[model samples]
Target: MKRGILLIAAMTANVLLSAARADEAAVRAEIVARLPESVGNIAITPDNQLIFSHHPFFSPEIRVAKLTSPTTFQPFPSAEWNTPRKGTYQYLDNVLGLRSDENGVVWIIDMGFRTNITPKLVGWNTRSDRLERIYYMPDPVTRTGSQPQDIVIDQKHRKFYIADENIGPGGDGSHAAIIIIDMDTGRARRVLDGDRSTIPEDLPITVDGKDLTVSAKDGKPSIIKVGCDGITMDVRSEWVYFAPLSGRSIYRVRVADLNDEKLTPPELSAKVERYSDKPNNGGLSIDYAGNLYLTAVESKLVGVIGADRKYSTYLSDAEMVWSDGITASADGYMYVSASQISAAAMFHGGKGENKAPYLIYRFKPLAAGYVSR
Candidate 1:
């Protein structure tokens, strides 16, 4: 009887494992780049070259890079931009998000945190390798506690939606909002300020059998509340989707409502709609088929929300720890970066515990076409 029960349990475990593998995306993970620095975001140029953002956590050098090989990368644009002297605002500082538009424009969002510099969106032409334009975040909007992390560019309307994580110096991301930028005029405005949709829930994030929080010098964990971290646009550029890293629900608003300059903050807030329930997501992207891809941090999975609003697991694995940034490329590939932030020294001691050689994984998307915004 005991042997029969054990055999049955083994068969059940095998069945469950097979089911889990079936739920994974049809295209498997293809390693693109492996670097010692912690990678934050990813972008694929028109020429199929890979570009990545290095989050200012594990190292100070190499803000952005273009993968020249599997293990080495070249500092993008120039080395001067990555190496900033004291009080130099011209250099890139703590860049977290990046996007490659169809127009051969690579948009980079530099969060002015480490150097107290003004945050800005920089557009560089990949073909020419020239800095095309720079739009500074309005001082008034970024005045108090603004950590703009990710961006979504709407080419149809020539606008940019930036997700202001609003995490303070101490890593307390209590305040959150969305900043809208007019690409043509270089003007910016804030919307949904302190609204429920943009705000984070008073909850703790757990990952890998540990709570997602910062560890003090004394080795005690303190909960860090981050809000409004991921932002993405629909295929038609009609809806802009976003969610807080500490929250579980995804929300979106119509692009037309955002373009209306007459709408006040409260009025814009009314236009926000709760889209769907998601896991704690680090990055969000949408395909041409209106499929939303999410790097679900807490669950260590890549989630997909179809056009029908049905939620399902696209990919999941133990090695997908702290999957940070996800982007769908024009070449029918979806790329994701694993930062391993939860295991960093900040959560252990002054000594970072993150393993070296962080990786970027790419896989074929559900449908072929450029990602929406």
Candidate 2:
């Protein structure tokens, strides 16, 4: 009888151990607000505060919010300058792309051609109450009047790397170039121009027991599009890493050659290297150990690309579909916004509209220090 009791106790202990092993820790910051619209980009400041950008269709303009605390976020008191009259000169269209400098200045890029105008980029001063330094993308990167998607700022060099996906506006696979911006002089240059670095991947979905989707952007029964959605500078800042939503492979290139306009297209293409395999990935971030984090799209997970370029799950959950706008902090957390952007009408076979009320999430790269026996 004692042996039977001991066996039952051992089974119970094993079950509990397995459960603990499968558990994941929560972020210190909570999902305080589900924005009425989709927030596509985010950058964490040194002060532990989060500066985010958001906009709704046919909206007034892009709005910025500052997190007062981990669980609370409110608009930065820039009402006077963000208004239509005083701030009318700034980009009125989609501010989908944003990046912050080491000095804490935030750069906002307006895709300019959202409603009626052509695509362009803009800048903002985080130290000020409103967007004080707004400007258009300089010439080299805008040869074909390109579209700006994501940006990464280099504080040491006073430059910004802009990813021109060129697939916007019912896009038909236009130019694929990375624009290097000189913040001090407001100049921009095109690098890796017309290189086949990025390819399209279909948005795979299972609905009503079948793959229900159509290509609204391409007018075909497909979901793939040439993309350059998320970008970030590595810890060393020597190379830039990026991936596309429809891309099957991840690519990176040295910043030194990218900044130099003298390199030819084929030469620049040779410099490009495949980084990883990320489907439906909308964002890229790096940890202190050089592992790359990607939004695993339908996987509802984040995969870390190691130094060997081998991938592993840093964190994942079944509810993680449509994750977007991810960034890593020096402290150890890789923050990502959990927005089911793929389930949107546009992402499927319906209208190209994204559903709103987005949520933010954070995960620890190293196992939670205190979460063990």
Candidate 3:
């Protein structure tokens, strides 16, 4: 009887010990940079460097910096893309999403629609400091024009899933969908075409807690606008997830179903899955451990949802305003960019000033244990 009681006591002690350690290691934060210019999205390159897309909507250059020493950032040359051969692709209209993978290649989603339908996807070799490859996710309607806004790559498979925002004039929100491209072949195909799963719901916008009305078209004022803005993927399950910028819900669809181009429209739409509710989120990224993280723009908070479906506020603080870009780093940290996009003058008829500025921040997370409430 004494031995049995001792065994039970030992088991109980182990459980308590594990729980205690987790509680001690929840999550930690450190501010990386504060800049006046806008940085829509951030991607940590395989070489352990940081690259961000600059704003002004029509900025011609993309900036690259080393985060090894976060406080001291020096710009690396981007002339590689400016060569005469690269031409028009060299200028950056708006860089919305950035990502890299095990392949050591850096991928950038340049939504050329900074003014119109100039959407494009480009890549670079961080190690060589050279432009690697580029692709135009052809429009599903014209099947010839470029159309893309965000990207989530499966490096192991060399496939990149591109989100088609389709925000051009005279365009319908129906074009919001996913595009899959095999890096090996440069071949691309439209997936989830006109699928309801990827359309934006026009979730009412509120600034300073007040409802704000904005038009989808740049010069024209109108309503009923829809476009997918953020996207990420679960490579293990071959699930590609995306969300509309003005929508309240996130959506997903299987890679296999999307890749089967042979399927008809109604047949493919059936594979679409309405994923989850990630209100006011501007971007998304999945960590190495299968946790999907989202930047809750209006809340100034970042959220993480594990494979178990348990949602947790990974990190939250007054510093996280208009959370724009989010990407996981290698050194036990997740990086975020507070672009304060909502604070942009254009977002609110230039009434709102960018007084809060913008910031890039990161935090180390406690993987398996609870650190705090």
lDDT of 2 by residue, 1-373 (tens): 7534533554454344333321243323335446555666676655455777663322435365665554455654355434434325543455556656654566666666545444455555555545556556644556443557678877656678887776655554446677777868877677765566743454443422335355565577653455566677665568888766666688888888677677777888888898777555677776544556677665667766655576665576554556677775544465677666566675445664454456777776532110000
* Model 3 CA lDDT for position 35: 66
lDDT of 3 by residue, 1-373 (tens): 7534533554454344433332234555578887656666777764557776654332534343334354444443354442223335564455556677655567876555544434566777777767788776545422322346567776546677777666544555666777788889878777665567666675555556855455644856544344676777763547777877667677777877777778888888777776666665667776434456777767777876555444457777686767877776655467788776566566667675565346788876433110000
- lDDT by residue for model 1 (203-262), tens: 887876767676666877767677898999875678999999888799999999977889
TM-score of each: 0.89, 0.77, 0.79
lDDT of 1 at 168: 50
TM-score attained by model 2: 0.77
Backbone clash pairs in model 3 (N, Cα, C under 3 Å; residues 3+ apart or in different chains), count: 4
Q: Which stretches of candidate 1 lie above 4 Å from their native place?
A: 1-27, 86-88, 215-221, 349-351, 369-372
- Model 2, runs deviating above 4 Å: 1-33, 55-62, 67-77, 80-88, 117-121, 128-132, 138-140, 143-145, 199-220, 347-357, 367-373
Model 2 clashing-pair count: 3
RMSD of each: 9.5, 10.1, 7.4
> In model 3, what are the clashing residue pairs, if there are any?
22-369, 22-370, 23-370, 23-371
Provide the overall lDDT of each model, using Cα atoms, as 2-decimal numbers: 0.78, 0.60, 0.61
lDDT score, residue 311, model 1? 68
Candidate 1 lDDT score at position 119: 89
